[model samples]
Target: MPNDTILVVDDSPTEQRVVVSALQAKGYRVITAADGDEAIEKAGREQPRLIVLDVVMPKKNGYQVCRQLKSAPETQHIKVLMLTTKNQDADKFWGMKQGADAYLTKPFASDELITNVTRLY
Candidate 1:
């Protein structure tokens, strides 16, 4: 079944709330993780349809978390979107290499985030 749940991961409380609010306003069932470790745990447990992950974070980081999630059979089916402040070409390439379904930098417009999330589904 298609899950409407979205996991938003970010270390910054302000950023997390902003993303969560935007997603919630669109009627997505939103959950949160303060860091990569929690994100992994929540993903496996919650099985959200999509994860909006931030690349720079305490421990694990987004790339590491995405790679692990993609490799793990239990959570591999979930789509990952790398949301980060790093906008460099190399950063994006690395995110894709880590098995991210899509990559979007921080300071993004709400519609842009929604568009990518919708595309993933």
Candidate 2:
């Protein structure tokens, strides 16, 4: 499972660092994108096992990226975990509607993120 690549997508450099570092510390091969467009491109090219996506981003939001990935036959099998600062119930429901496999809010514990990523495999 550690061999599986995970794409970490966020516009915030700080959030990206935190999640990427956490995942790398767990020995997972992690890649990152600064925005949703890059996220979608990387998801298609890299064929990552999972994508850790942020809700708000430039070019495209997580919901849009998630919807596109889920809709595409080649990418639909990849697990999507919506990790964002949006903690509202409606936001979570929307993420689910977009086909997120799991939804995690910001300020999440490293262990929790690792646990969620591991569970996906």
Candidate 3:
């Protein structure tokens, strides 16, 4: 739904733009953060329903952010989808262990992104 906001966290400008554009085109209220710390701040401040998180980032990483968010009562309700280039099975397992709702690798299709986001809604 357009009413639900999504926070996209990635250090890469191009990747951030691509994801933001795709989500905006799909009618979601999209917000963005360039790294993990910013992601955590925006997630707390904006209270977005979902967060599209990147694994490798400065200040902090997706796993750290997800773990912190899940542990905090204020942010524990937010859903996190790990969107990163880390495609290893261990990466997915660790992400899920940290409370990620979904794990999608890089080079994902726009439709797949939309579908996963919609499922979260």
Scored against the true structure, residue 54 in model 3 reaches a CA lDDT of 95
26 Cα displacement, candidate 2 (Å): 0.6
Off by over 4 Å in 1: none
lDDT of 3 by residue, 1-121 (tens): 1238999999999999999999999888899999889998888888999999999999999999999999988899999999999999999999999999999999999999999999996
Q: CA lDDT of each candidate?
A: 0.93, 0.93, 0.93
Name the regions of candidate 2 deviating beyond 4 angstroms.
Answer: 1-3
How should the candidates be ordered by TM-score, best one leading?
1, 3, 2
RMSD of 3: 2.0
Number of backbone-clashing residue pairs for each candidate, in the order shown:
0, 0, 0
RMSD of each: 1.1, 1.9, 2.0
Across residues 16-120, which tens digit of lDDT does each residue of candidate 2 receive?
A: 999999999988898999998999999989999999999999999999999999999889999999999999999999999999999999889999999899998
Clashing pairs in 3: none
